[model samples]
Target: MVIYGVYIVSKSGGLIFNHDHNIPKVETEKVFSFPIDLTLEYDPKKVSVAFGQKDGINVGHILTSINGVAVNGNTTEEGNDVKELIENEGNYPLTLKFSRPKMTTNEKIFLASMFYPLFAIASQLSPEPKSSGIEVLEADTFKLHCFQTLTGVKFMTVAETTQTGMDVFLRKIYELYSDYVLKNPFYSLEMPIRCELFDANLQGLLEQIEKTGITNI
Candidate 1:
């Protein structure tokens, strides 16, 4: 019934399929072609979606409400309402409502590539826009945690489950950038992070961290 462990609603609002991370197996066919940039954060509420894909949710789909509760103003309040509703609903299929605007290129590709936040793409993509904070997310296999700086640089890692000290870990990553990549005159200031030295150091750091046992991560 489900492909790719996820159901996608087509552009024409047609029934594609249904599945979630809890699903054990997903065929490869039911994949979303478009790279989605959803406005999970309520602040600076302008656009809801972005990027290119044919049979997928287009750019600029205005999310009006979640589970019949309108997202009027005060996103924190609306976010709470959504959370309570979902908890009470026992995690069933949610009736989401949104308005579609004419699709256009967002043209803001600051990052050359995204590291495929598996949880975001599979389950949902949104976060409370605050500061360089850490969030732990559930995924099909591993627990995914991320921290993003104000300047929009993101560092993420996969673990077996949620752990503390994640904020500190993310800060260490930023520190590595400050010490190696940014200071190097030859390194270009960009999103893709194409510095070989940075990559090597990051991997070495990860390996060192990995040996500390799962809970420490």
Candidate 2:
């Protein structure tokens, strides 16, 4: 049960907000593993590492293991331990494993933009009149769940195929959006959401969902 990302697409086909969850990938024998020696630039402020001009690793990759030590703690104290290990100066030849999202931000934005037209086509081609377009698109590995508000803003979640209760989760996302984004005085209509309050609340919500899954949230 893992959520890869959340995307908020505006009525006019603009990407307002995109959030990639830092979840460890489910280990499988079928999955390929490759070792790449690359220079890493760590941002203390973000507690994240970035590879200089590197391919493969993306921004939302979660630090799963470091030097054979599994850093899979969710609690504060456990997280502090992982932080300490990362900041320690003596640990050299860092062997790290990360769970990275499949798509990049640019790719996500492009997909979101393409969805509007796809939605329109779906509605037109529907057997029943007044169809609501594509709702849930299930694939071999992932599931895309979408809930469109009356105003045409679509809240979408990319999650594991077996995960459920995404409709409820998306509704909660709408409630949070209404509260933190729509209600913010500084927010411009249909613009990219930049509210700190919204980001904080959404991150908290994502963390909750990550820990407990959609049903628990």
Candidate 3:
């Protein structure tokens, strides 16, 4: 049987996360197997686990016993074990383990469903600007660039033309930047927004504008 633990770390090399499972939450009667193969299933994306052999021990061959009930994979079915068996009530453990190995069909489906919308949004967020004729203004307070698109629309940016720009005419850019870029939990002030989430939101807004049938100026 495989023994496993979950841990989260900062990009800066800080130990900011950890989790261990003691109980199962979801039902696995029809799904899962021994030697669980874990994969992340979430929007905004999340971390997943992969086990390795240790001391010649096959960690992938382990089984999970939740509340005296045995199930395979890294997830547990509801009622097989008491809720919060792994962590505690209201506290979600970041890591879990399973008996047996291999990714379950249900697990893969769940992961895909969880990430598909995010993936769609990301595809939309790619920077495919529709050429707007706006002029860039170089000034002390901020630098600006402008472009005019084929549609007779004007696009302008101030102070380094980030995903977010200063002031109106560029309000959408600023709003997109403020909410999706600046307000991101992981982003710092003045930092560029280049994550999957940012891209998704950006694409969504641009698509909305495109659909509105507004002529550009």
Candidate 4:
């Protein structure tokens, strides 16, 4: 279970925090499916997991195609295009092709910003009123788990498919945010988190997870 990184977004769709873990790797060619639910009877769980680092896709890979349609851009527009394509129930057993290219810090920030409107659009497009936005975005190589606080702040974690108890872990991160950032008088609301205690606690928590392999906390 590899944790790629964590990103925190403000209520208004600004990126407040971004942390990328230092995981060594070598670029290799691989292809895999990204999991998505459709209105059809097909079960999403039937999708296979990524093979491994030797040939498996991981974070920083640029999505180049969905099924046979070529996709470009890693910006919000590209995300919306992909979202619309995925929502088309006809595209079952989705085939996603990716090219491994290290994502820059600016790209991560742009991705976070792009997701904000997508989340809102998802809720608005829902047939059911008062629907919760996207929670989990699963791919053959990685799984993105998102937790939205009542106040509209969002905490997201990027990890592998085998990672468990991430929801519980996200809630703990929220607690840490509340205790360390919210309570800090020097901290600015809806701004980048830079409190020393918050950074210390977050790093300590991540170190604990790395050492114990205990994600439940």
Native-referenced Cα lDDT, model 1: 0.44
Candidate 1 TM-score, C-alpha based: 0.36
Clash totals for all models, in order?
A: 1, 0, 42, 0
TM-score of each: 0.36, 0.63, 0.23, 0.63
lDDT of 3 by residue, 69-92 (tens): 543334454433322343344333
Candidate 2 local Cα displacement, residue 188, angstroms? 2.4
List model 4 lDDT by residue over 1-217, tens digit each: 6677888999999899987775445333333333432121112311112333324555344555665555555223234455555556665567765555556778878998899999999889999998889889899888999999898999999988898878887887899999989987877768898878877888877877877775435
Q: Arrange candidates, best lDDT first.
A: 2, 4, 1, 3
Weakest 10 consecutive residues of candidate 2 by summed lDDT: 27-36
- Candidate structures ordered by TM-score, highest first: 4, 2, 1, 3
The whole-model lDDT of each prediction reads: 0.44, 0.72, 0.36, 0.71
Instruction: List candidate 4 stretches off by more than 4 Å.
Output: 22-24, 28-101, 213-216
What lDDT tens digits, residue by residue, belong to model 2 across residues 1-217?
Answer: 7887888999998788898885455321111123334343444422233553234455545555565555544212235455555446554435666555356678978989999898889889999998988899989989999888899999999898988888998999899899988887877768998878878888898889878777777
Consecutive 10-residue window with the lowest summed lDDT within model 1: 1-10
| Better candidate by TM-score, 3 or 4 | 4
